[model samples]
Target: MITDPEIDGDWDTAQGAESPERLTPRERARGGPGVRPWLWALGGLVVASAVWAGGLYAFGDRLSEPTLSYRPSKNLCEDFKARTLSGLTGDLHKQRPMNQESDHPAVYGAVCRLNNVEGMPDFVVAAQVDLHKKTDPSTEFDVPPLADIATIGDVRAEAVSDLGERAVVLTSFGGTEQKLKVLDGGAVFTVQVSVSTYNEKNGRPATDATAVQAAMIEDMRALMAALRK
Candidate 1:
């Protein structure tokens, strides 16, 4: 019988070869060549996690903390003179102004309400100041006017330029009510003026939306200037 030397050699090698060695419990637990890829993957994940944690610890505050340009007012009524409104409405009367202030680690807030006076056309002006101590107010600065739109239908919003980092005017109640909001750095300023539609004593139209918006913007600028650090 003629036999191929290559085939005979393969059969002889296969018959002479012993069974593969079995791994002990300790050796199996320690891992084998098959487990090397998984060990490398685990080591890579550990290194990545350490890097991320170290980065957060080193620069988290610098990246997250906001830089505030303005300071909080102790009394918003004193800071907000409402001079433009006084001119438009009339002389300031003896009505007591409402003022509130709060100071905390995260934020500082102040609110003022100047009620309607006898000599002036029936109008109320409210001013609010928010100085964010920890975070940037810009993200949520435009939210109030938007909320006003959702709450009070028929409201119109217009963006005002050259006032601050950003400014918006919200008009409602047939131009009788106007709200001006300005955001600069971490500070937020809001001025809202509500006047009667008609003057009963003078028998004249009271609300001039354009004039009110102008006055509101001017006064808001003044208020922002007054509260700056």
Candidate 2:
């Protein structure tokens, strides 16, 4: 009775029996039936790229904005009032003081070098101001002063209060040189005074170390005020 389904008129039943499904010519031209998975993978990659780009844009904007409250001085030598140092040394060098200033997107800096008469006390005073626009300097601010003790013999460093967010004073070379550093917000201020031992041998009484440090602190406050204005 089953003489041969193919030869019989029931050929349609034989053709539909146990045959695997096949894609149309149109489907094959469009990358077969698995193309939807490929499209989904591509769409996921695009979304991830967009999210990464947005994050970078937001972070860059935050870094570009300045966080400092104080401003940079056009001429540090002219703006700084060295009354305390002048009172002790009599007068600064007649020649123009050496000064440097810079303004940039990430930072602002000013520095001034004031020296006493050649033979008087022969002292040198250096003042500097730094305004950080992007990052906080507190973590690294105290490292240098503290490191001096290990690097140099007879160096002393102590923390100071009431000057700013944080302050430090470093004295070296038997109190002949003193540096005062203060950090406020994102601004860093430093005042350093140093005198040579030759000045003591030349019959000029050695300047009082205590008085020198006090004068430095006083002048630093004045300098900060001037820059703020």
Candidate 3:
């Protein structure tokens, strides 16, 4: 009853039988037949999670904001029709089809310029549509220092009420321009009606600022209503 040396070899030889390469932390865990498969699976899951987190950190804002597509009716002039003051009215002229262009990330905008036939003060209407972005339009609602916050035509708006029918204006784009911004259906609609009554060219009064402002408000109101339809 004798035991062979090869069969009952040294424990060091048995341990070194697998491989001589240096094993990494993961490789060490995958060394033997007795190694649990769940551990390998868990390691894989951890790697996947790290990749996903990195992606989110890199592109969070862009992924959240949706891209806007263009449509023919979304053109600036066509969507916002040309209008003139009722009594002071002459001929209403609409410029070329205002193309919808990207204003900012996830925001598309366009403006339609309208000129008076009688050489009166001109008007411009602009629209900005947010392409399903979660951005709040109220950020653009900031008015001038003394501007009044009032409700016009069932919508709460910030305006220069003291202008008293001369102009319904607000501060925007770093408070450099005076305009109207209406937030509706993931879009911001803006209107700019000239407040000048005296023609700069002839130095004579042409269109009434008060009348032009009133007409601008009504025209904007009508456009907003149309968007709802």
Cα lDDT listed for each candidate = 0.76, 0.76, 0.48
Error of 3 at 115 (Å): 2.5
> Clash pairs of candidate 1?
none
Provide the global lDDT of candidate 3 against the true structure: 0.48
TM-scores of all candidate predictions against the true structure: 0.68, 0.64, 0.44
Backbone clashes, candidate 3 = 0
Looking at model 2, report the run of 10 residues with the lowest lDDT sum.
Answer: 11-20
Q: For each predicted model, how many residue pairs clash, with residues at least 3 apart or on different chains?
A: 0, 0, 0
Tens digit of lDDT per residue, candidate 1, span 28-65? 66663245577789999999999999998876664576
Predicted candidate 3 versus true structure: per-residue lDDT over 163-207, tens digit per residue: 212233553322223356554444556675443332433332365
lDDT by residue (tens digit), candidate 2, 71-128: 7888889877788877777556454688998887677899999877554546889899
Record all residue pairs in model 3 with backbone atoms less than 3 Å apart, i.e. clashing.
Answer: none
The ten-residue window of minimal lDDT in model 3 covers 148-157
What ordering of candidates by lDDT runs from best to worst? 2, 1, 3
